[model samples]
Target: MILHKDFASVVGVRRIGKTSLVRVSFNDLKDNIIPLSINLGRLNGKNYSVEDFSRLFLEGVTDLIKNYTFVVKLPE
Candidate 1:
Protein backbone atom coordinates (compact mmCIF):
# COMPACT_ATOMS: atom_id res chain seq x y z
CA MET A 1 0.00 0.00 0.00
CA ILE A 2 3.04 2.32 0.39
CA LEU A 3 1.35 3.94 3.38
CA HIS A 4 4.33 4.68 5.65
CA LYS A 5 5.38 7.51 3.41
CA ASP A 6 1.98 9.17 3.57
CA PHE A 7 0.60 8.37 7.06
CA ALA A 8 1.65 7.04 10.43
CA SER A 9 -0.99 4.88 12.04
CA VAL A 10 -3.67 2.41 11.03
CA VAL A 11 -6.63 2.36 13.39
CA GLY A 12 -8.55 -0.86 13.94
CA VAL A 13 -10.00 -3.12 16.61
CA ARG A 14 -8.76 -6.49 17.86
CA ARG A 15 -9.18 -9.69 15.77
CA ILE A 16 -10.12 -7.50 12.81
CA GLY A 17 -6.94 -8.28 10.84
CA LYS A 18 -4.99 -5.15 11.76
CA THR A 19 -1.84 -6.99 12.68
CA SER A 20 -2.02 -9.33 9.74
CA LEU A 21 -2.44 -6.50 7.28
CA VAL A 22 0.37 -4.46 8.80
CA ARG A 23 2.69 -7.42 8.87
CA VAL A 24 2.13 -8.23 5.24
CA SER A 25 2.25 -4.63 4.11
CA PHE A 26 5.32 -3.76 6.11
CA ASN A 27 7.14 -6.82 4.86
CA ASP A 28 6.50 -5.69 1.32
CA LEU A 29 8.10 -2.33 2.03
CA LYS A 30 10.85 -3.37 4.43
CA ASP A 31 13.59 -3.73 1.82
CA ASN A 32 13.35 -0.06 0.94
CA ILE A 33 11.74 1.50 3.98
CA ILE A 34 12.22 1.01 7.69
CA PRO A 35 9.43 -0.60 9.70
CA LEU A 36 8.75 -0.59 13.42
CA SER A 37 5.97 -2.80 14.72
CA ILE A 38 4.77 -2.45 18.26
CA ASN A 39 2.16 -4.47 20.06
CA LEU A 40 0.34 -1.59 21.75
CA GLY A 41 -1.93 -4.11 23.45
CA ARG A 42 1.14 -5.05 25.50
CA LEU A 43 2.05 -1.40 26.22
CA ASN A 44 -1.00 -0.44 28.23
CA GLY A 45 -0.81 0.83 31.84
CA LYS A 46 1.83 2.56 34.04
CA ASN A 47 4.89 0.98 32.52
CA TYR A 48 4.14 2.44 29.10
CA SER A 49 5.66 5.91 29.07
CA VAL A 50 6.52 7.86 25.91
CA GLU A 51 10.21 7.65 26.71
CA ASP A 52 9.97 3.90 27.04
CA PHE A 53 8.15 3.73 23.76
CA SER A 54 10.80 5.78 21.98
CA ARG A 55 13.57 3.59 23.30
CA LEU A 56 11.79 0.44 22.26
CA PHE A 57 11.07 1.84 18.83
CA LEU A 58 14.71 2.74 18.21
CA GLU A 59 15.82 -0.64 19.46
CA GLY A 60 13.54 -2.35 16.98
CA VAL A 61 14.93 -0.27 14.12
CA THR A 62 18.52 -0.97 15.10
CA ASP A 63 17.74 -4.64 15.35
CA LEU A 64 16.27 -4.66 11.86
CA ILE A 65 19.34 -3.08 10.32
CA LYS A 66 21.62 -5.50 12.09
CA ASN A 67 19.62 -8.53 11.02
CA TYR A 68 19.26 -7.51 7.40
CA THR A 69 22.91 -6.54 6.67
CA PHE A 70 21.77 -4.60 3.66
CA VAL A 71 23.64 -3.21 0.70
CA VAL A 72 21.88 0.12 1.09
CA LYS A 73 23.80 2.30 3.52
CA LEU A 74 22.56 4.02 6.68
CA PRO A 75 23.70 7.20 8.33
CA GLU A 76 26.37 7.21 11.00
Candidate 2:
Protein backbone atom coordinates (compact mmCIF):
# COMPACT_ATOMS: atom_id res chain seq x y z
CA MET A 1 0.00 0.00 0.00
CA ILE A 2 2.81 2.39 0.82
CA LEU A 3 4.67 1.61 -2.36
CA HIS A 4 1.59 2.15 -4.49
CA LYS A 5 0.51 5.23 -2.57
CA ASP A 6 -2.76 3.64 -1.59
CA PHE A 7 -4.76 4.52 1.47
CA ALA A 8 -5.88 1.86 3.96
CA SER A 9 -7.97 1.65 7.08
CA VAL A 10 -7.60 -1.10 9.66
CA VAL A 11 -10.96 -1.62 11.29
CA GLY A 12 -11.57 -4.11 14.04
CA VAL A 13 -12.63 -4.41 17.64
CA ARG A 14 -10.47 -2.83 20.34
CA ARG A 15 -7.13 -4.50 21.26
CA ILE A 16 -7.21 -6.50 18.04
CA GLY A 17 -3.72 -5.47 16.87
CA LYS A 18 -4.89 -3.01 14.21
CA THR A 19 -2.53 -0.33 15.45
CA SER A 20 0.30 -2.79 15.86
CA LEU A 21 -0.01 -4.06 12.31
CA VAL A 22 0.10 -0.54 10.88
CA ARG A 23 3.03 0.44 13.08
CA VAL A 24 5.10 -2.54 12.01
CA SER A 25 4.25 -2.04 8.36
CA PHE A 26 5.20 1.60 8.46
CA ASN A 27 8.36 0.86 10.43
CA ASP A 28 9.47 -1.59 7.80
CA LEU A 29 8.78 0.95 5.05
CA LYS A 30 10.07 3.99 6.90
CA ASP A 31 13.03 4.40 4.61
CA ASN A 32 10.80 4.43 1.55
CA ILE A 33 7.91 6.52 2.82
CA ILE A 34 6.82 9.17 5.26
CA PRO A 35 4.28 7.92 7.75
CA LEU A 36 1.70 10.11 9.41
CA SER A 37 -0.59 8.64 12.04
CA ILE A 38 -3.27 10.93 13.43
CA ASN A 39 -5.71 9.76 16.06
CA LEU A 40 -9.09 11.41 15.64
CA GLY A 41 -10.32 9.66 18.76
CA ARG A 42 -9.24 12.75 20.64
CA LEU A 43 -12.23 14.53 19.17
CA ASN A 44 -14.66 11.87 20.28
CA GLY A 45 -17.44 12.88 22.72
CA LYS A 46 -16.75 16.55 22.05
CA ASN A 47 -18.01 19.22 19.70
CA TYR A 48 -15.04 19.40 17.36
CA SER A 49 -15.00 22.07 14.70
CA VAL A 50 -12.99 22.39 11.52
CA GLU A 51 -10.36 24.36 13.37
CA ASP A 52 -9.93 21.52 15.82
CA PHE A 53 -9.45 19.02 13.05
CA SER A 54 -7.03 21.33 11.28
CA ARG A 55 -5.00 21.75 14.44
CA LEU A 56 -4.71 18.03 14.89
CA PHE A 57 -3.83 17.49 11.24
CA LEU A 58 -1.15 20.14 11.33
CA GLU A 59 0.24 18.72 14.53
CA GLY A 60 0.57 15.37 12.83
CA VAL A 61 2.35 16.95 9.88
CA THR A 62 4.67 18.87 12.17
CA ASP A 63 5.56 15.67 14.00
CA LEU A 64 6.20 13.88 10.72
CA ILE A 65 8.56 16.61 9.58
CA LYS A 66 10.40 16.56 12.86
CA ASN A 67 10.84 12.81 12.72
CA TYR A 68 12.04 12.81 9.09
CA THR A 69 13.81 16.15 8.92
CA PHE A 70 17.21 14.53 8.45
CA VAL A 71 15.92 11.73 6.30
CA VAL A 72 14.14 13.74 3.63
CA LYS A 73 15.70 16.52 1.60
CA LEU A 74 13.66 19.70 1.16
CA PRO A 75 13.65 21.79 -1.98
CA GLU A 76 15.13 25.27 -1.81
Candidate 3:
Protein backbone atom coordinates (compact mmCIF):
# COMPACT_ATOMS: atom_id res chain seq x y z
CA MET A 1 0.00 0.00 0.00
CA ILE A 2 2.99 2.23 0.50
CA LEU A 3 3.51 2.89 -3.19
CA HIS A 4 5.01 6.32 -2.67
CA LYS A 5 8.05 5.13 -0.77
CA ASP A 6 10.30 4.04 -3.65
CA PHE A 7 8.70 5.49 -6.79
CA ALA A 8 6.08 2.67 -6.83
CA SER A 9 7.27 0.31 -9.48
CA VAL A 10 5.60 -3.12 -9.51
CA VAL A 11 8.26 -5.29 -11.03
CA GLY A 12 8.78 -9.04 -10.90
CA VAL A 13 9.59 -12.07 -13.00
CA ARG A 14 7.41 -13.35 -15.86
CA ARG A 15 3.98 -15.01 -15.24
CA ILE A 16 4.01 -13.75 -11.68
CA GLY A 17 0.46 -12.35 -11.81
CA LYS A 18 1.41 -8.74 -11.22
CA THR A 19 -1.11 -7.61 -13.77
CA SER A 20 -3.76 -9.95 -12.41
CA LEU A 21 -3.33 -8.52 -8.96
CA VAL A 22 -3.78 -5.02 -10.28
CA ARG A 23 -6.82 -6.06 -12.25
CA VAL A 24 -8.40 -7.67 -9.21
CA SER A 25 -7.72 -4.63 -7.07
CA PHE A 26 -9.18 -2.39 -9.73
CA ASN A 27 -12.30 -4.51 -10.02
CA ASP A 28 -12.83 -4.48 -6.29
CA LEU A 29 -12.64 -0.69 -6.08
CA LYS A 30 -14.19 0.20 -9.43
CA ASP A 31 -17.59 0.83 -7.91
CA ASN A 32 -16.41 3.48 -5.45
CA ILE A 33 -13.35 4.68 -7.34
CA ILE A 34 -12.76 5.51 -10.99
CA PRO A 35 -9.62 3.83 -12.21
CA LEU A 36 -7.79 3.00 -15.43
CA SER A 37 -5.26 0.18 -15.71
CA ILE A 38 -3.20 -0.34 -18.80
CA ASN A 39 -0.93 -3.32 -19.49
CA LEU A 40 2.15 -1.93 -21.13
CA GLY A 41 3.34 -5.50 -21.64
CA ARG A 42 0.73 -5.91 -24.35
CA LEU A 43 2.19 -2.94 -26.14
CA ASN A 44 5.60 -4.51 -26.05
CA GLY A 45 6.57 -3.50 -29.57
CA LYS A 46 4.65 -0.27 -29.81
CA ASN A 47 6.47 2.89 -28.88
CA TYR A 48 4.59 5.35 -26.69
CA SER A 49 5.64 8.52 -24.98
CA VAL A 50 4.43 9.92 -21.68
CA GLU A 51 2.05 12.20 -23.56
CA ASP A 52 0.58 9.20 -25.31
CA PHE A 53 0.15 7.34 -22.05
CA SER A 54 -1.54 10.34 -20.46
CA ARG A 55 -3.85 10.72 -23.42
CA LEU A 56 -4.79 7.06 -23.29
CA PHE A 57 -5.40 7.15 -19.57
CA LEU A 58 -7.56 10.26 -19.81
CA GLU A 59 -9.50 8.86 -22.73
CA GLY A 60 -10.24 5.66 -20.81
CA VAL A 61 -11.34 7.56 -17.71
CA THR A 62 -13.56 9.83 -19.78
CA ASP A 63 -15.21 6.84 -21.39
CA LEU A 64 -15.78 5.16 -18.03
CA ILE A 65 -17.28 8.33 -16.56
CA LYS A 66 -19.59 8.65 -19.51
CA ASN A 67 -21.03 5.21 -18.94
CA TYR A 68 -21.11 5.24 -15.12
CA THR A 69 -23.81 7.82 -14.49
CA PHE A 70 -23.13 7.65 -10.76
CA VAL A 71 -19.93 9.46 -11.55
CA VAL A 72 -21.90 12.54 -12.55
CA LYS A 73 -25.12 12.12 -10.57
CA LEU A 74 -25.73 13.98 -7.32
CA PRO A 75 -27.53 12.67 -4.25
CA GLU A 76 -30.05 14.86 -2.46
Candidate 4:
Protein backbone atom coordinates (compact mmCIF):
# COMPACT_ATOMS: atom_id res chain seq x y z
CA MET A 1 0.00 0.00 0.00
CA ILE A 2 2.81 2.39 0.84
CA LEU A 3 4.63 1.60 -2.38
CA HIS A 4 1.56 1.96 -4.52
CA LYS A 5 0.01 4.95 -2.79
CA ASP A 6 3.26 6.64 -1.75
CA PHE A 7 2.18 6.99 1.84
CA ALA A 8 0.67 4.99 4.68
CA SER A 9 0.30 5.44 8.41
CA VAL A 10 0.20 2.62 10.93
CA VAL A 11 -1.33 3.42 14.28
CA GLY A 12 -2.19 1.36 17.32
CA VAL A 13 -1.96 1.31 21.08
CA ARG A 14 1.40 0.93 22.78
CA ARG A 15 2.97 -2.55 23.02
CA ILE A 16 1.23 -3.62 19.89
CA GLY A 17 2.99 -4.70 16.66
CA LYS A 18 3.13 -1.34 14.89
CA THR A 19 6.88 -1.03 15.16
CA SER A 20 7.40 -4.61 14.16
CA LEU A 21 5.28 -4.17 11.05
CA VAL A 22 7.19 -1.05 10.02
CA ARG A 23 10.52 -2.72 10.64
CA VAL A 24 9.53 -5.61 8.43
CA SER A 25 8.37 -3.27 5.70
CA PHE A 26 11.61 -1.30 5.83
CA ASN A 27 13.68 -4.42 5.70
CA ASP A 28 11.85 -5.50 2.56
CA LEU A 29 12.07 -2.13 0.83
CA LYS A 30 15.39 -0.73 2.06
CA ASP A 31 17.23 -1.63 -1.14
CA ASN A 32 14.94 0.64 -3.16
CA ILE A 33 13.59 3.05 -0.58
CA ILE A 34 15.11 5.07 2.21
CA PRO A 35 12.87 5.37 5.28
CA LEU A 36 12.86 7.73 8.24
CA SER A 37 11.35 6.27 11.36
CA ILE A 38 11.46 8.29 14.56
CA ASN A 39 10.25 7.75 18.08
CA LEU A 40 7.48 10.29 18.36
CA GLY A 41 7.07 9.61 22.06
CA ARG A 42 10.37 11.37 22.64
CA LEU A 43 8.85 14.53 21.16
CA ASN A 44 5.48 14.27 22.85
CA GLY A 45 6.01 17.23 25.17
CA LYS A 46 8.96 18.87 23.48
CA ASN A 47 8.87 21.92 21.23
CA TYR A 48 10.20 20.49 18.02
CA SER A 49 10.04 22.39 14.75
CA VAL A 50 9.56 20.99 11.29
CA GLU A 51 13.16 21.82 10.53
CA ASP A 52 14.17 19.59 13.41
CA PHE A 53 12.19 16.75 11.95
CA SER A 54 13.64 17.39 8.51
CA ARG A 55 17.15 17.33 9.92
CA LEU A 56 16.52 14.05 11.66
CA PHE A 57 14.93 12.58 8.56
CA LEU A 58 17.87 13.54 6.39
CA GLU A 59 20.30 12.24 8.94
CA GLY A 60 18.54 8.88 8.94
CA VAL A 61 18.52 8.69 5.13
CA THR A 62 22.19 9.61 4.88
CA ASP A 63 23.04 7.06 7.51
CA LEU A 64 21.21 4.37 5.56
CA ILE A 65 23.00 5.29 2.35
CA LYS A 66 26.34 5.29 4.08
CA ASN A 67 25.97 2.12 6.11
CA TYR A 68 23.79 -0.15 3.98
CA THR A 69 24.55 -2.07 0.80
CA PHE A 70 21.89 -0.08 -1.06
CA VAL A 71 22.99 1.39 -4.37
CA VAL A 72 22.07 4.79 -5.75
CA LYS A 73 22.98 5.46 -9.33
CA LEU A 74 22.74 8.95 -10.67
CA PRO A 75 21.51 9.57 -14.14
CA GLU A 76 24.01 10.33 -16.84
Give model 3's TM-score versus the native structure: 0.41
Best candidate according to lDDT:
2
Better of 1 and 2 by TM-score: 2
lDDT of 1 by residue, 1-76 (tens): 6655555787677789988888888778746766666666666656678987887778777887787676757899
- CA displacement after TM-score superposition, residue 11 of candidate 2 (Å): 2.6
> In candidate 3, which residue ranges exceed 4 Å CA deviation?
1-9, 27-31, 42-47, 70-76
Ranking by TM-score: 2, 1, 4, 3
lDDT of 3 by residue, 17-58 (tens): 987887677688644554455555544356867877777677
Best model per TM-score: 2
Q: By the lDDT metric, which is better: model 1 or model 3? A: 1
CA lDDT scores, all candidates in order:
0.73, 0.80, 0.64, 0.73
How far is 46's C-alpha from truth in model 2 (Å)?
7.6
Candidate 4: C-alpha lDDT: 0.73
Worst 10 residues of 4 by lDDT: 36-45
RMSD (Cα, Å) of model 2: 5.2
lDDT of 4 by residue, 21-71 (tens): 998988887466756666565453578888877777777777776776667
Candidate 2 accuracy as TM-score: 0.68
> Which one wins by lDDT: 2 or 4?
2
Return the TM-score for each candidate structure: 0.53, 0.68, 0.41, 0.51
Model 1: weakest 10-residue lDDT segment is: 30-39
